[model samples]
Target: MDSKNKQQNDQKKSTKSNGNSKSQSNQTKSTSSTKKQKQARFGEEHEGKLLEFFVEEVKDIYFAEHEALKALKKMEKAATSKALKDSIVQHHGETEEQIKRLEQVFELLGEKPSKKKCEGILGIIKDGESVIEDTDDNTMVRDAAIIIASQKIEHYEITSYGSLAELARTLGKDDLAELLEVTLEEEKQTDVTLTILAEESINEDASNE
Candidate 1:
């Protein structure tokens, strides 16, 4: 009887040990799965932030381009030089293409093309408006003013596109980088054109006036 009782006690102990081992194993698996989920969430959050920043930069330029479109019309009207006015209209056509390129960039990134209120562009536009208002109508002074203002806008665009293109490259978006670089080159060209216009005749004419 003593031996039988001892055997029964051993059996009970074995069962208890198995139960504890299974419970511990389940707990470990649960903990590991929780850790994996947390890691995945963290990675997603980080990626989300980077994408957000890229999108915001795109929006800023989008807004600037639209502002420029409107300002270009006003500058064309304010310009006294026939040549300058024609250049302004030419730039208007370029602006249309630039906006479309930006929209393509948004599509490549799987995002909607959007814009934010660009205070910098707005300020430049307002500055141009004031210059027009302050200067006498149909005067070379206004032409000079329009040229200078347009150059400022072009410079801003060059810087913005350069940075954005670099960011796209860093983010491994080669296609986006290429598109932005094209726009950047255009902006640089426009800046140079404005400078030439100012140097060749507009500035000298203003000085004479």
Candidate 2:
């Protein structure tokens, strides 16, 4: 009788332990689900001042990307080096993709895409245009000038994307931030490529002339 009672008691204790373990697991899952819901709510909430500022900055980048596309095309024509022209052509496509991503970001915010005048991009585009006009297109100096102009645009993009990504993350917009981060990495890579093209031959060739 005592042995049977002990067995029953042990089984009861084991079952209770299993029940508690399952309950805790469910509680943890519920907590995680709640956190995700809050994050979703954060996205759906109406824009306040920070979000307004965030959207304004996004518009700046959005406008810059469009302007950069035009500048790249003109720079591609201005480039004497086949390699540099090809690079600009490739980046022009990437900038197009970046523009689409920005439009998606606008969709995420429940807003139609709008532009804020980006004077910085405007200034850089003018500089690129001036370089082309001042240099003879067939010369090595023109290739060097194109590289300089392209890299300047790339650096501006890098700074803009980095800031936008940081801001997106701060506002709990991880999806948007990741998109900007992708562009930021591309800009950095393009700058590195431009530097390589210059250092390997273009700059030296230009200096010889």
Q: What is the C-alpha lDDT of each candidate?
A: 0.87, 0.85
TM-score of candidate 2 on Cα atoms, chains taken together: 0.76
**Model 1 over residues 16-132: C-alpha lDDT tens digits?**
555767887577557656865886798779767887898899999999999999999989878898999989999999999999999999999898988999888899889878878
- Number of the top-ranking candidate, with TM-score as the measure: 1
TM-scores for every predicted model:
0.79, 0.76
lDDT of 2: 0.85
Candidate 2: minimum summed lDDT over ten consecutive residues — where? 10-19
lDDT of each residue in 1-209, candidate 2, tens digit only: 25698578656655655566778757756765686588557655744667889999999988898888888887877788789888889899989998999999999989899888888889988997897789885899999888888888889999999998998997889999998898899899999999999999999999998
Scored by lDDT, the top model is 1
